[model samples]
Target: MVESAPVAEPAAPVESAPERVSAPASEAAASIAPAPTPAPDLDPGTRRGVPPVAAPQPSSVPPVVESTPAVAGTAAAASVIPGTAALPVTGGDALVLRGVTKRFGSTHAVDGIDLTVPAGTFYGLVGPNGAGKTTTLSMIAGLLEPDRGTIHIGGVDAAAKPLAAKRLMGVLPDRLRTFDRLTGRQLLYYYGVLRKLPPAVVESRTADLARAFDLEDALGRSVSDYSAGMLKKVMLAGALIHSPRLLVLDEPFEAVDPVSSSIILDILSAYVAHGGTVILSSHGMDLVERVCTRVAVIVAGQVLAEGTVAEVRGELTLEQRFVELAGGLSDVEGLEWLHTFSD
Candidate 1:
């Protein structure tokens, strides 16, 4: 019992000391330690996977650019050209005018007109008896000079360069004067020569026109012996023999028969389809209304209105609009003698 007691007391006398604690370092002392070595060539300004810093640029340096001397010169030259304001002309249309005016003494036959005929367009010029339609067309055809304006044909200046402009045009004046003694075929031949068309082309075109116009039988006869309709057909054939880019006509259907008129209209339509230009003047408003893609209506030597037929008429009928704008045909309609029956 005494040995057991002694062992228990010894075990009780054994004591444990408190565990030791580590002290925290100051922020300034931690910062003084060297940082881990950066990866090779790593930029200090960039984060992981980011691009390296760019070299500094000079603030006074200007941007680099290429120059276009030829293009710049062309644009500058085009700006200086007269009539550049008229239009941005292109293609092979026979006639164009801008601000065109013609005055015969005090009569302003045409006043400040602008016209553009695209290649392959059948354009109509229409107006009352004394309207300036004819005068406007004449200036375009180079038959008369405009008091103030510019006319271009196939990009050739009409005023400054008449010959080159006229070369692109074929004209049939309102009152045509032909040699009465010459036969129909001979007349066409003469005009073909005057136009300086090649002989082969002249021959082929003449033959085709004679057949198309039903003038083969009358070709050998003198123009003086032909009827009014026949003469008109002959003159039309003459006007077309050279295959001009632009064909100008004044009242091409005046003396033509219904059958001939239909044929001529078809021919003109085909001509335009094949890249030819046609500027025709006619008092037959109904025909012009039917066939023209664009029209200019002149009254008292001034353009009263211009546009497509449907555009100009708006809600009113073309005939009604025509009457309203150009004055009613009441004076002519008032004639009562023609209705009287003979005894």
Candidate 2:
């Protein structure tokens, strides 16, 4: 059985925060960090995890990396050059988006955002609610059409040659919807089959992924019986079966338990080390800062900052920098009625 989550000491409030203090390590961390859970034993796979409770990773000074500018445009639509090649081609960049925009009636969910993710990078996309993070990811995944701009996946235009582009990617949507009646094994088998893998290969990979994700015992149970964390794990396993070059995941770690999150992180780190690219959206600033090689901060559908964690979060922690870029935590004043409640 997976060990229960660790209980770390709570952090002091921001008002009296210390300068560069490392969070005390959790007792469970020592036991969990060892060989009980090894990295995924995969032949090869694609894709890319909570309060991942353990030692709180501090965002101390990171090495300086130059920023990559993503300029916004007032224009509603972008023009693509006619006769451009749409076939898949190898490129140094794993993904690129230029002047991307998505409109929902009057609202511009994603407004003129530009981003480039290099091959083998673990990139994080972060923003507050309705900041176009999801919208931007959806467009890249080909779930939603952008009003303007072009997206390329491994140099294959996502909009112009969507099928070819999708072939290079594995996506874990923010909303988790699946055949809940199916067993975890069944789900993974079906995923592999859909990816055109032979049954024999799918079976072998399924067991490998299940063991890595600690779902070996749960594989027989229907997905509906699984907890939120298990559901995420199964879906993540399904996403990786095909071994696509790029993984576009949105909120990949939300609601995940600490143990599962740690396993997933290990798997992703290994995958990136083996030359896979991951672009994921997350709300955990510290987690992103620690795991991601690059990060992009989007606010009001515009990229406010883009670059290495060091460059964007200069003097402050990632959370503090995000709050500053996101309009500085909305003046906290008027709640006098709450102090004198009816109770």
Best candidate according to lDDT: 2
How much lDDT does each candidate structure score?
Answer: 0.58, 0.64
User: lDDT tens digits, residues 1-343, model 2?
Assistant: 0011122211110000001111121211111100011122222223210111122422331111111111011111011112211122233898999999989899988899999999878999999998999889878877678899999977878776655566666677677765666678877765665544446655765766776778889999987899988988787776666555677778889989987898788776655654667899999998999999999999999999999989989999999999999998675589777789695
Residue by residue across 210-298, what tens digits does model 1's lDDT show?
A: 76677879988877799988977777766665445677788889989998888777666655554566789887878988888888777
lDDT of 2 at 89: 26
Which candidate has the highest TM-score of all?
Answer: 2
Backbone clash total for model 2 is 1
The number of clashing residue pairs in each candidate reads 0, 1
Question: TM-scores of the models, in the given order?
Answer: 0.68, 0.74
